[model samples]
Target chain A: MEFNAIYVIVAREFKKFIRERSRLFSAIARPLLWLFIVGAGLSRLVPSDTGVSYTQFIFPGILGMTILFSSIFSSISIIWDKEFGFMKEILVAPVSRLSIVVGKALSGTIVSTIQAAIILALFPILGFNLSIVQIIAVILICAFTSFSISAFGIVLATFYESYESFSVIMNFIVMPMFFLSGAMYPVKLLPEILQICAKINPLTYGIDAMKHVIFKFETGPMSPDIPLIIDAAVIILTSIIFVLIAGKAFERKG
Target chain B: MSIIKVENLVKRFSDITAVNDVSFEVEEGTIFGFLGPNGAGKTTTINILCTLLAPTSGKAFIAGHDCIKESAEVRKAIGIVFQDTTLDKDLTARENLIFHAYLYNVAKDKMQQRVDDVLRFVDLYSRKDDLVKKFSGGMKRRLEVARGMIHWPRVLFLDEPTLGLDPQSRTNLWEFIAELPEKNKVTIFMTTHYMEEAEVCDRIAIIDNGKIIAMGTPEELKKAVGGDVIYIKTTDNASAKNEIERLFKFNVSEKENEIYMTCGMGDTCIPEIINTIGEKVISVRLQRPTLNDVFLKLTGKTIREETSSGNDIKDFVRAYRKRH
Candidate 1:
């Protein structure tokens, strides 16, 4: 529970993030491609009954995807640290193991949030009008989503020994999570089994909560199948569970 | 008071015992060395003492704190320079030290001054702003040493501190390590395979195959090899060894064509030994015993022979050739 130790870890990660200019570029590029190319192209092929444009409808999903990818990849640095021997220094320090886990999780959250914020700044170009309340809601939801996803990443990073194995496993899990979360399409239109899978996904709650706020602001307040309160509850509960699991995994001998 | 105590400490990895029934004591403010060949459990013992790896049985204490039960206190009281480089390559030297200071909970106001002091101590203050990735191997090792001392722990554990450095860099690093006890009042527990490096230690424990074979001061261990070693090369080696053993009443071992034995004042005995078996003696050599000779006498093999399968000697040879 030493806040200084946590702060120092977070500060070092941020310093590394800032220095790696290429990583920052890729973080923004991936979401923009989905928004401009994928959203625009798919919208022309399949028209939506909702009055909002396809670009507007998928904006929140794109933001969620950016946060998901960035936060998860951020935790891969743990494996790199282990390979390079820096992790041993951290493991032997007087700080509690929980602080190291929390510090890494928090840094990933901040990095993903920053990446999401960059996408949020482009709202004007996308021709979306938002009130002060909706803007605050979007930022808050992004933070919560980023924190949850980053914790999940830490849990995986702890168990994985090498980047090759981690990358393979992440691709296996990440693609399914992203596709089934209804980021590209609405869950209501999916088959029964697909809908059930989407319902169980923690990310489904995040995107649903964001869509609720964004769509409500664009149109009148629409009652989604999953209420905002339920989405918020699931996101918070999942985050706590992930943080605890990651802390336990990190306590194991490296 | 002993700064470190290990009693019957054991560590096993599934079927193999990496450290077995090890026992030793390191007095405060002295450099205690573990000299052995590779895979001889030297690093394992150091890891157990540092709290990075727990012993399977038995016990260890650092600064009177149990390494297992009181790991937090033990961790706070000791610093470690791992065999491999542990500094963050992307960060500058100052940033790396600052991060270490924070992790050890150095006071916020004193952090900058402490970082500066350690950087200066390692003589890397001039390049503090450069990224560690740009540093030479010796520079990186020096920085790791400085980083380990940033918090000023009561004990320092250096695992193969100069494993891959050139002779000059190794000597330079030893100079810095030798001064740490007097300058910083830190007790050092180090493990090295190099016989020459072990000479700097106040006392050394020679380990092989996960057991301590001998423990004492350098001079004492060397003396344990007997007064002197005599190597006699003869046309008929077996006859010469038998002749010497019968005349001098000494035990002799032969390898290849040379008959080797230890005798009191080998310089004085060589002439008598040659004269007693005058026609048999082709050449004779008399020499004082070294730590290598001590290890050979105890283990029946030189330290380098034990490590022929490992890369330490190969890397040493490569580094030596590169320098030449």
Candidate 2:
């Protein structure tokens, strides 16, 4: 609905994204710090059960981390827009709430996917070779994961009015989701209660799916926490559901 | 013909009624001003008319479309310049208009031409490529007005379009807005606290405490006050006020340190007031009734007293932030 409205929103975001060079730099640099500094240091002590190196074991988690931060913060633009009153201009336009939600989700997905791809290109530097097919699959997985998180972020954004309150709430939600996502560690190593939380987090499926693509073997303790089909299904289903919820949330703006 | 209509609109925020049983019609191709003090439901009424808010009861229609049921059509038919600046400060003036055009679904072929025309109309054509963050307060407001009209909606709602601008810029922006009804064939429904700005409107509605206290052309409203106004500042205002009320039998109101009253033939009454009142008068002035006087007579409060309260600090901060 109102496809041009969606296009304009996407284009406007892209222009702002390009202008803010520091944001792009920081988005890329944060994940690299985790991958190189944290992953490299932990790789020595946290030896993997599988033949895969510890650096490679958490590499998928690194990608998940990149997507999680970038995609979720992309919705922060909404809070900024609200603060600056630009959201009122858009809300008064002849566009559907669905178009606005889809446009935001698409822009977030694209931006986070681009950041994830930059990190994915570092596979050679990490001494792990990925086939072109595997690389494309990983990118697709990153896009789906980013879309779901972005939609969920939009859903949360609708409930907030100020950057301070939203940031406070985001700290409460984002950090736990990251820790429980099996991003820095395997789900099997987690406490039983945390394992339940990991199962609930959509990002867990995302990182697990990334593990399926990058790792050579699927039958080990370090293997994906869930089946590939289940991971994909959860992400796709969550994305659709979050987007619908976000669209409905916007209706209450009236 | 009436292009905008509201039938007994009432909006309540929890237990407080922000807009209560208000109804009015705006004719096509005219400038209708909504004059009210702060929190007088002016913005609330505009929000409902623009389809940004739904009323708890009653109905509003814009350009023949029901504001609640046919909101999309109403949105398509209206453009608003909010009391605060809403332009994307990161984007260029041209890009902002183009974005608005797309959101309003302007024809692809005509989009560029429309954007150019509006930029030129607002006199921001020279700075079209510059980021809005670099613009002065006045320039940003002009661009917002330009963007509001780029879509050529049937009605343009301006909620205090020149609230923060300097007096010179206010006059300049007001000139552009005053021309829209005739030059662009668009109905203008604006809310402002500036009495001078409200004077230019084809019709004015003075709202207070969520009610429309008076509605008419500026002349008609001012005439209803039925006298000239006299301002007296004396050494003793309490006795001066009581003395003026006793001697002239006029309804006296004290604002700040000055005592003012509305009385017929104020020109002749001024000398009599100075001579007969035993108190030493510090100053005396007489003037014809203005829209502010009418508002004061109706509401027992001066419109300027309410609006000018916090403006100095805001002006200072804005002036300090100006970049070249």
What are the candidates' interface root-mean-square deviations? Answer: 0.7, 0.9
For residues B99-128, what per-residue lDDT tens digits would candidate 1 score against the true structure? 999999999899999899999999999999
Off by over 4 Å in 1: A217-225, B232-260, B267-284, B305-324
Which CAPRI quality tier does the interface of model 1 achieve? high
Model 2, span B84-198: residue lDDT tens = 8898999999999999999999999999999999999989899999999999999998888889898888999999988988989999888888888888889999999877689
The whole-model lDDT of each prediction reads 0.87, 0.89
TM-score of each: 0.91, 0.89
Query: How high a TM-score does candidate 1 get?
Result: 0.91
Per-residue lDDT of model 1, residues A1-254, tens digit only: 88988999999989999999999998899999999999889879765566677788789889889888988888878988988899999999988888888898889888888888899889889888878888889888988988888889888888777778775866787888899887888777779999999998888888889898878543332224477899999999988899888888888855
Top model number, DockQ: 1
RMSD (CA, Å), each prediction? 4.0, 6.0
Q: For model 2 chain B, give the 10-residue run with minimal summed lDDT.
A: B315-324
Candidate 2 residues A74-138, lDDT tens each?
98789889999999999999899999999999989989999999999999998888899999999
